[model samples]
Target: MDEIVTFGGRVTLGQDRQADDTERFLEMVGDRVRAARNRRSISRKTLSEISGVSQRYLAQLESGTGNISILLLRRVAEALDHKIEWLVGEEDPYTSDAVAMMSLYRQATGEQRMRVLEILDPDNPHLRRSRRLAFIGLRGAGKSTIGRLAADRLKLPFLELNEEIEQASGMPVNEVIALYGQEGYRRLEKQSVERIAATYDSIVLAVAGGIVSEPETFNYLLRHYHTIWLKARPEEHMGRVRAQGDERPMAGNPAAMDELRNILMSREALYARAEAQIDTSGRGLPETLDAVLDLIEKRGFLRA
Candidate 1:
């Protein structure tokens, strides 16, 4: 239309001012659309073909000059394997616009969609605080510290599963795994989780990183507790574990780096099944705690 895009308070444009607002909005939208498209490796031509929004207009849309209807925007997002809300640049914060876009792209193309769906759209009997909430992620993920801090902040009792495991088995996790095998240790884990689930109230649980190995146990925990996967890059995980004077993680496993990365990859689907995920990457303890607080607040729960 060779007209400048502008956002108008009116439903229809008033020639000059409308053109200006629409143009600004269009530019912003186009910038976002292009970035999203590039991140997904989606070509402009393919989006045009699927959305039927035309290459010229698409280019203009990307340039912040074209203003199309939401209907057409939906098609464009769909073609890009995104949601209509993705174009809106906001969400309830549990699903930010950028995260939604990345998640949608990852889901459409990645193999982790099933697990992602379980977390993104879970089956819950109640929306209230879970009695057996668990935090499952790598060590040095601030589980004990964060779990304790969150418990203190919420005035809830916090229990470390590993401490329980060691007390129950009278052995370290590695020794337990070695002597009893993964299955035997998992039996203990299942029992521990089930016991907690069957008992307790207002918990901020800290689950073992390997807990996901037992899908049944993990799923059972999910049915009860609001799980949060404290996420971080591999380097950060190793540093945290080491900082805690836990060198066993690096022992014997000569390929510890690759192994940890691969382990994360393998269990990512399982970890992603939690009620919520907090990215502790490059974030301090306060920031991380604040994020957890924010998540809890947004979930519509009163702090313990």
Candidate 2:
């Protein structure tokens, strides 16, 4: 009884663990497959049609008798938009909200998750953010210049998120993106935000315009910082970039201006979510700086 004897009468190490548990494993797989299908509202016949597996075989598999092949199981998993590991793993996906919540969260858009967070945690944002302020807008919105000037005048610490990213990464922002790709860079950026939130209580921060395109990061900024949208006309944006000698925006692309306009139009709503806005469309450096400082003071953004 201690040793397992095969057909050739060759005894092997105790019982084959997998062999002895085959029935349990098969039952578990069947239960998972059925639960996944039911959760997705797909009948066995429909799943069979989608998975290209025979209905009889699927019925046997679900009844916990058929030893389904890996390839066929993979097909069923794909048909259910699930991973093969999830189907075969010991953990019951439906037993815990954490697993189900993560799946739902991963499938949801950034705006949807943001709204859900707002509903789930309706704490006072002003108090949560403390005295931190963030300036968000396109590249030429004068965020760095105005933010620095305002921070100097207000005697508050000023930090550029890109600079922080570069410092933490030991490389430039472009190099970080090149080395880690956009998704990796985004992860690093989120980490930087968390670090800043935990580090300094009062500071002026400038962030990239594309930050709004990322819903979760933007939502974090909204919750933890007094955000200001520094907007400018499309032409002004281009001109300012050109003035800074950064011809990258319109270097060789003839439709660069149009592209810039399209980007602005697309992100307008996201940027508009800021607590306040300042249009530096036609304003000079001094005027824009004054406007930003005035808005911050008038809005009492730094009030604790």
**Candidate that scores best on TM-score:** 2
Q: For each candidate, what is the lDDT?
A: 0.78, 0.89
Off by over 4 Å in 2: 1-122
TM-score of each: 0.56, 0.60
lDDT of 2: 0.89
- Mind giving the per-residue lDDT tens digits that candidate 2 earns over 1-304? 5676588896755466657698889988998899899999989999999999999999988889999999999999999998998889766776867778878988988657656666777686766687899999998999999999989999999999999999999999999999999998898888898789889878999998899988899999999999999999999999988999999988789999999999999999999999999999878989988888888889888753
Cα lDDT tens digits for candidate 1, 86-194: 6665442233676756657654732354345457666543432344456889777888788889889888889988778888899998899999998888999888877
